[model samples]
Each structure stands twice: as structure tokens, then as C-alpha cells.
Target: MTILDKYILKRYLITFAVMIMLFVPIGIMANLAEQIGKMIDNEAPVNEILIYYGNFTIYIGSLLFPIFLFLSIIFFTSKLASNTEIVAILSSGVSFARFLRPYLIGASIIAVLMFLMAMFIVPKASAGFNEFKYKYLKRGREDRVTTNIFTQLNETDFIYVSSFNPARKSGNNFTFERFNKDNQLDFKISANMIRWIEKDSTYRLTSYQKRKLRGNREIMETKRRLDTVFNFKIDDLTPVSYVAETKDLFELNQFIEDQKKKGASNINAYKLVKYKRWALPVSAFILTIIAVAVSSIKRRGGMGVNLAFGIFVAFIFIFFDKVFGTLAEQAGFSPLLAVIIPNVFFGVLALYLLQNAKR
Candidate 1:
């Protein structure tokens, strides 16, 4: 790399490092202030609190990675433009595309780090962060689905319940069904109530009735109560909402496959987390290009103008991401499409801005 490339890349990395250092503590302090009372009320231990904040750094930082990259790039590049450093480098016959090489290199480095964090590091932090939040901060709040649940256990097995009580480890109007390989109903079990007997490790069903279909006849049986064992756990009836975010890349892939097998109702939500991890690295590149194009030009209003525009764009990008993510989770929108739309839009904007900046 030439001296110019070295100079630009150094500033790119240094400014980003400084930005993270400066802001993360402020974020931690603000969060601590807001949640300190909750922690005290819950009697949270000091060591756990310390570890939670450590995880908080990674969890929150990963979410805001693109925004920080955008703002830092704008801040440093605007300084270069304002001081005529960019002009000096460009005037010496460096092509506009060539001038962008160091910034791209810096972005590539950060992108790889972001990829690692998103796939592996952030998940661990997310697990810790969420565990602490739900355990202490959100005490007594509902953590799992409790009403009108249905799940396909396998190709031939299915289960449903009208309502569940986690504390009681039971459900009302529980029904279990098994089908033949040919998709014929083999047998079905219905119960007025089903409860997990923890001491005995068995499921107790009250007002139980079973009907079995034979080749030429149907067999029926009824009982006041029965004890049985099944392939799934009580918790499996409704997974905690943040389960996807807490899993690493490989684990998440396996989980999605399992959820798909079960015909999970919220499969799109898990799929979104998987797609976003892949998309995040791509976003680093898009945001970097947009930042350079927006800020690496001298303007009458100076750095403030560049920063204001950067903040606006950052908010818009986040808004689109959150909106599309919600649509995928709540509606039946394609998770892959939700991930792609915002990145594709911003990628086009980056190209347009780069062209204008070149001229």
C-alpha cells in the first residue's frame, strides 16, 4: 500500500476505535441508571450484574455496528475534506475509485469482524444479556406462549392445547394425534386437562379418551385419568421468544431445521435472525460506501451538515430494517426478502452517491 492508502486507512480504523470507546461507556451508564432500581429490587448479585454489562457491550454493539461505522466514517472523512487533505490527494491524479481503495480495505476488515461477531460472539452475549433481563428485570412477566398452541411433532404426530399454565406445568383441552404413513388417522387422544407430574416424570391426563382406527373397525377407550409419557417436554410447547437470537450460526441452522420439522408457527422469526446475520457483513460495505460518498466532500456547512445527514440516513436505515423485520415476524412475509430489500435499496443509493461524488 502507498503512503496515501496507509494514511487514510489509519484514520479510518483509529476513528472507529475511538467512536466505540467513547460511546459504549455512555450507553452502559445510561442503561445502568435506568435498570439499577430493578436490579436492586430483584436482589441481583454484583458479579452477575458486571458480567451482564460485559455481555451488553457485545450484544448492543453488534446491533449498532453499521450505524457506528456510518457515523465514524462521516466524521473522519468530513475532517479530511474540510482540511483539503482529500483535495490534495485527488489533485495529484489519483482516480476517484483509486482514492476509495483504502476505505474499502478498512471496510473489508471491519466486515470480517462483524461477520464473526454476528455468527458467534454476539449470540453468546445475547444469551447472557437476555437471560439476565428475563430472570431479574422482567420478573413475573409472561415468557412463553400460553394460549391456543398447536405443533406438529413429526410427520405422523401432532399436539394441541387450548391454554397452558407454566407454573402449574399443565394445559387444558389437551389433544394428541397420530397418523399413519399414508396420512390416515391411526389414533387420537383427548383430555380435559394434562399436567406434568414432576416427581414421577409422567404426564397425567384427566378425563382421557382414546380412539384407534383399525382396518375395518374403530376401537375406543375412556378413563377418568391416565399417566403417560411423550416424546417432547412441557417447555417445548412454547419456546421463549428470544430463543433464536441466543443460538450461534450452526446451532441456529439446526434449530431452524427442527422448528421447520415441527411446523412451528413462528418459523419466520427464527429465519429472520439467520438471514440478518448473513446480511450484516454486506451492510458494512454498503454503509461504508454511503458514508464516504456523503462526507468526503467539502461543504459550506462543514462537518455538522455531514453528521446531521448521517444521523438522518442512519435512522431511516434502522426504521426500514425494523419495519421489514416486524412484517416478516408478524405477517407471512419472506424472511429472505425482508433481509434483502433494505440492503439492496441502500446499495443502489451508495452507487448513486458515489457517482455524484466522483463528478
Candidate 2:
């Protein structure tokens, strides 16, 4: 609203925009250079390749937003301090806290953008990006789990498989069971192999056997083959590894609830995706404070010294995020803690640096 707020806010937004514009193409080029050979080998379509880069711009750019914002602030604010603009403003009776108002506004703007992108937009981009990566880029790797698969369709229904072939829509050592309301076994079915008959829309079970409980007696039946239908889909066995990242906010919440009901082993991985979206926006404020604090003081090494410090802090922030994220995904750590720790640590650091800057 004030002249000073407008002036600082304009520079804050412009520098961030410029930083993204400058670096995103560099990222695309670097990615293309690295993955071009793979594209050639796989005979990927031209249109899909173009689309992948577009998604790449959204996905990777959103991932690096905090760093870009941080570095941009340090870069521009360092220059302002170097030119004695900060000193002049302060000498004119502007409080340091008042000077920070515009920076907070800029951070607020970026945070909302990040929240929107992460919750809705980037998920679509992420789905497309990871789909392309797995389809053409990492063809040899299995996108879905293929062995020892288990899923609970409902409170009373459970299924298990020793091994599954997703392409064939078949599995070996298949077993299905259902229980009564009293938790008593109602019936159990086993098969040497089960395959989905696409033309008939039925599941064909080879070497089938079924056992039914009748009060205290067990009745057994066997058959060479049987065709039947079940409520659960084959894809429910093991979805793609990035399944969580592909869902919008509402869908993701519903998905996590479904997975929890089914006793999914990788629920932590899904939770990590949800928690990070919230954490990413909160980080915008923390990073902004730290960036301004570190870069607002004139130094002998000028902007170079401030830039170096910014980069160092940025690296550490990213390092902590990746480490905790990996732990949540692979090591079964708490997803909330993974998102909370890095932000809290950096938040405290920001407060310390802001006090020093004010002094």
C-alpha cells in the first residue's frame, strides 16, 4: 500500500519470476541432454516428449520453488544493502520490521501458488511425468508390485497371491477368504493359478478348492477349474509406486482412507505426499525470513558472500527434506515428523538470524 511496500514487493516478485524463467529451461535442457539417448532407444513419440517437458517444468519447478525464492531474495536484497538503499531507508525512520512487510506479502503470494499447484495442478503433471518415466524411460523396472501381494477388500473379505503377472492379469497360489459377522470363517477358496478372462469378464481358477464352515463341520469341494466373479479388481493388488503422488487433495484423502482400511503396507508413503504439500507452503514464509535476514546486511564480500550463505542454507534444507522423506517412504518413519522437523529447524534459524539482523 505504501510506496516502500510497493517498491520492495515489485522487486521481490520480479526477481523470483526471473529466477524461475532463467533456470527452468536450463533444467529442461539438462534433462533432455541426459535422457535423449533413452528416448531414441525407446522410439518415443515426439508429442509425448514435448508434453513430458511441460510436465517437467511444472513438477521440477514446483519442487525447487522455495530454493528459487530464497536465492532471489538474497540476490536482490544483497544488492540493495550493497548500494546503501537499506541504510537510507532505515535512516529515514523505517523500522526493520516495517521493511519486512512487503517480503512477507511476496512470500504469502508464493505460498498460495505452491499450495494450489501441489494440491491440484502438480499432481496431474506428476502423474503424466512419472507415467512417461516408467513407460519409456525405465522400461525394465516393474512399476507395480509383483510378488507376495495381499489386500483386504472389506472387513470380511481378504485375498493373497504368491506371485502376479500384471500383463497377463494372472496370479499363482491364489487364495480368497471371507468371514462372518461373528469373526467365524465362512468360506475359503484356493487355486493353483487365477487368471482374468477378459472376453468373458470372469476369473478362471485352475486346481480350485473351496472349504465352507457349517457350525462345527467343514465341507470341502474341489474342481479342476472354475470361473467366477469377485468384487475386487486385480489392480488393487499393487498399484503403481507413485500412485499417491498422482491424486488430487480430496482424492488423496479418500485414497489414504481406503488404503488404511485395506491395511496397506505403504500407507506411510501416501501420507508423506499429503504432508509435504502443506509443509512446502509453510516453508515459503520461513525461507523468506531467513533470506531477508541473511542478505540485508552489507558485507566486505558484497553480494557474493550473501549468495554463498544462501546456497549453503538451501542445500542443507533440501538435504534434510530428502533424508526425512526417504525415511518415511522406505523406513516406515512418521510422515508428520518428516515434514515438521526441517521446517521447525529452519524456522528457529530464521528467528535467530532475524534478531541478529535487527541488531
Tens digits of per-residue lDDT for model 2, 14-61:
999999999999999999999999999999999999999999999999
| Candidate 2 accuracy as lDDT | 0.94
Which digits, one per residue and each the tens of the lDDT, describe model 1 over residues 1-359? 99989999999999998999889989999999999999999999999999999999999888888999999999999999999989998999999999999999999999999999999999999999998998889986646778888888888999999998877889999999999989999999999999999999999999999999999899999999999999989888878878999999999999999988887778899999999999999999999999999998999999999999999999999999999999999899999999999999999999999999999
What's the TM for model 2? 0.93
Question: Residue 221 lDDT in model 1?
Answer: 99
After superposition, the stretches of candidate 2 with alpha carbons farther than 4 Å from their true spots are 145-148, 162-172, 192-207, 223-228
lDDT of each: 0.94, 0.94
Clashing pairs for model 2 are: none
Top TM-score prediction, candidate number: 1
